[model samples]
Target: MTEGETPAQVGASSVDIKDVDVIAPNFKKRLSGVTSTIVQLVPYQMKLGIRIATLGPGLPAYLPHIRWTGLFGLWRPPVGRRHRIWHARRNNEMLAGLILKYVLSMPLKLIFTSAAQRHHSSYTRWLIRRMDAVAATNSRSGGFLQVEHTVIRHGVDLDLFHPPQAQDDTIAATGLPGTLLVGCFGRVRHQKGTDLFVKAMIELLPQYPDWTAVISGRITPENKGFADSLKAGIAKAGLERRIVFLGEVDDIRPWYRRLDLYVAPSRNEGFGLTPLEAMASQTAVVASDAGAYAEMIVEGETGACVPAGDYGALRDAICTYLAAPSLAALHGKAGLRHARDTFALENEARSLNRLYEALIG
Candidate 1:
């Protein structure tokens, strides 16, 4: 199955129960980072002969999946294999794996991937302890894990995000104001540091009239007031036309290519991917030291990293590019090379397949 296939055409029934070697469970209903990871990686893993299938709802039809009723078939091992690997990324999925392996006495090996940098709760620790294997999305996540785990950082789809054919043409297509564009994308909330980016732009954009700042992300109902306040601040700064809010975009790849610089001022993250995505788009980045931002960036080469939540540092970082846009192009070239050689999705898929194969063996 591939993109744009209908559910009827790529239904779970089409995939044989005996062929599945790994079950990647996504218990969440809403779209999230975890869901995005599964959607992006599964097709690659399948191409690499991992025989993995998702076991949950809310996923796209392009993925190989097992229906909820298919859980009954777990009583029998897949083909000649002794057991299947149950890979979980959430607490509830971990519980489901535990029940499948222990409660039901199924032929399964449980593996959990952790991305949180914070220490685990007792309940979460309990789940990790019972897993047959664990993987962390980054070094910081591994540090927070109680069990031994492999550090397999997430990777970006290079095909989806690459350097623009013509930077000026891409920027013109956006129809946004200004010759140079800097962007901060994600949820518009305090934790994401949307206000910090806004405040920094409010202070910097007037001085550097050649640049425009763009923010693109979802604004939930609860955070409407927060988004409103930021807009109010932009209005008060008299830079409303200069600093624009793009809300949530359908495809952010073109937007990344349009950018001369990208700022990811997130106060916190569970292995942020925007910096790498920007790098893949041949755009330089200025990101806070959150999630795997530090791990991904080459620091001063691809871009710069500052202490998370530091407005002074963020403003200074953006000002560096605004003062000398040529520097952004230089760094952006380096960023594209780094992203291609280091953070390609194929690398991540192979690393994960090795781990899954080892567990199955």
Candidate 2:
């Protein structure tokens, strides 16, 4: 199966189920960071001529994916290959792969990608120990793993997210009210430090009338009150007009390109990708040292980094960029160069492909 080949089409066609080279499983319905990574990477891998297909649900129907019923087909050896690589990102997926390889006696080489920045649970550790190979998203995440693993940092699609050719026109098209736009994106929740970004903005936006802040993401039902409280604070500060919350835009690349500066105030993350995405868009970043953010940003050159949950440091960093617009431009250009040179999506896909080949060989 390839992109645009639906499950129905796959069923109707003469495509052989035994030819899949890799299986990337989702398992969960909600769109999570892991799902996003799989969605972004699989297409590139397919273009590279890797026979990859996503399993499980919640992904776009158009993505190259096999039906859940395809699990039985794993019992047979893939044509021209001794075994298929089952790449699992979550414990449940690892467990399923284990069952297929062990109980069903399928010829599958199980590989796992670990992105969690903290210690794993006992069960997860056990599952990790059983994997044929493990890949961590960063050096810090590798430190948390009990087993030996390779560090493969995530990358962004540079073509989809590039420097804006016309900055003023891009901002105007967003319909956001500001000559200078600073954006904080991700889920609107306390753990993500959305409140901290709001607090920092409340203090800074009032002083700089030319600057406005935008928070774009989904606020889940449980976090409705938290979002409302932040809105209330903005109202109380009398800067409601200065700050805007454009809840979860489908295309966030433009939001990144239009920003004068981008903030990733996550208190916790599993290898945060927002800062890299922002840098790919040629936007300078001010991010907390969460996930692999400290590793991603070249402080003072690309962007600044602060201690997680330290709103004072965050405010100071944002203030420095706001005070010196020239500095922000320099950082943005440097960040763009850094991202393009180091973090292209093809680099990541090729690295993973090599690793997959080594395991299978």
Candidate 3:
């Protein structure tokens, strides 16, 4: 058993509240980008002997974590520490930290990582002011913050997402048609611009018969009708077989490896990571100018970026690669190099650890 694991708690390493130096709270029940980051990062932080543990749901079974009941024990500081750091990614989590520190008088230092690229609401601005420290995923997000913040770009796990060991074999296993693959992976919604990708593919794929387009992600209940309409459009264009949708993939790393090019067509995002993930997988990307995508891709060098929600620009940008497969391959190699040097997951963990150490000290 780990430091705090009891006989009743079956899965996950539950760290003792007293021993924890940092508390990373994931309040959301759904699987979001924030939740995914906490899951991937906590284990890395623990391996570095940071004594950080996750709090709340949506995490895997093996990462270090504390039960919700552990909140009761927060009144006292952890052993060998003046106060424990409460690291929050979302507003609700930040609010909870404020409550714990101000209302409950817990020995906690509040830290909030802001990824949003929009103007903060009055409520959000008020909350950010109370934080002991802040982190912005990129420069633009930092610009949106009224308070000072450290800019730390999110990164991908290069080990998990890398150049395909056997690209042809991986592609064949998927049973998807075509020699070259273009994919858009995320939730299917208008804001995500799934329709724009589909429209671009409809117009482009028929000319380039060897290239297939894949859409892999979940279509939530509210967006089911929207997804259905896209399918209908695909069918009308007689490109049903050419364009595939693999819904809610279990492990997306392999899927990234199989692609020649990846598309992130979201109209808006909170520090998008798919382009970085695709870049790490040695896949060229054509992402929209959303989130931190413009900062990620080097235009013609690694990949191309189109104006968000611009159908004509999206189509033209994709056609640039479809017209020349060699260019995509060349960009893919450069993307791999860039991802390795600038966006390794270890880099993100180490950066965050440095921030945590400052606060904890």
Candidate 4:
């Protein structure tokens, strides 16, 4: 067994631990973007009978996962293959896989998926260099990588996130005020442009009294003061009732459906998924030119794309849709069609499976 792994720690049943084709490792205990990707993708892969299993902490128990003790079994040849695929999305996972393949002599083929848009450090570059094959979430991300890699954009689960049957009833059920709703959902922080979203709402909500705005996300301890400051600003404008802060919610799908227009004003991102989620929910989006948002959004069709960190441009984009509700509805319908036709979750799973098959062959 690997260091720190004991027989008593093996959580998987003996039957569940055997004959795994792909080992998706998530080392972080916290739920992050990387962890979310694993959580979404693995189940779909398993549904296709891929024999995939996750290795690490934090994933939901419902997902098929083996414990640390399962690492010992990797020393032997995988069923019907010389090596199994170790898909790592983080630096630590790659390092662990490197040790298992080289130091411990496990029959494993390493695959690293990168979503970072910025330059990589020397250490990260070295780890990436050792990978047998690499996958980038977008074309821009692939350009930043020094090594050759396939560009595999992320896809949303169309079944889970879709247009609501009754939009008004859905919003009224939540008990949030306003006939019309627009939202910016994600972690409330400067980098995420949460403040900009609030500022834009303050300026615009007064003219459109029938409409309201919402911010749904967490504010960490360090950013608690920042959040308080936004609340203070909203109170100062006397628009607290109109612009609501839901904080964090368990399921964000309902929130997306309730929104007539969705805004992702992030200053930076690593393949942001919020816009895609909104689109899949048949909500028109106004996203900043961050991450792969521009790639995902079709200007004037699916949604509008604004310059990052420009609140004025963001304000104007929101106004354009607010003034023309029909245009907004048209965009929403187009977005739904675009999301289903282009970004289906099954497509991504099948593509990855093809890659795995090619590598194994």
Displacement of residue 41 (Cα, Å) in model 2 is 0.4
C-alpha lDDT score of every prediction, in listed order: 0.89, 0.87, 0.88, 0.88
Please write out the lDDT profile of model 3 over residues 43-131, one tens digit for every residue.
66665668888889888777778898988999889998899999998889999999999999998989999999899999999999999
Error of 2 at 49 (Å): 2.1
Per-candidate clash tally: 0, 0, 0, 0
How much is the lDDT of residue 153 in candidate 4? 90
Highest TM-score, which number?
1
Clashing pairs in 3: none
Model 2, residue 43: distance off in Å is: 1.4
Kindly report which residue pairs in candidate 2 clash with one another: none
Which 10 successive residues of model 4 have the least lDDT summed?
Answer: 1-10
lDDT of 3 at 95: 96
**How well is each residue in 5-92 modelled by candidate 1, as lDDT tens digits?**
3332344333666788999999988889999898877877876878888888888766788888888999899987999999999999
TM-score of each: 0.95, 0.94, 0.95, 0.95
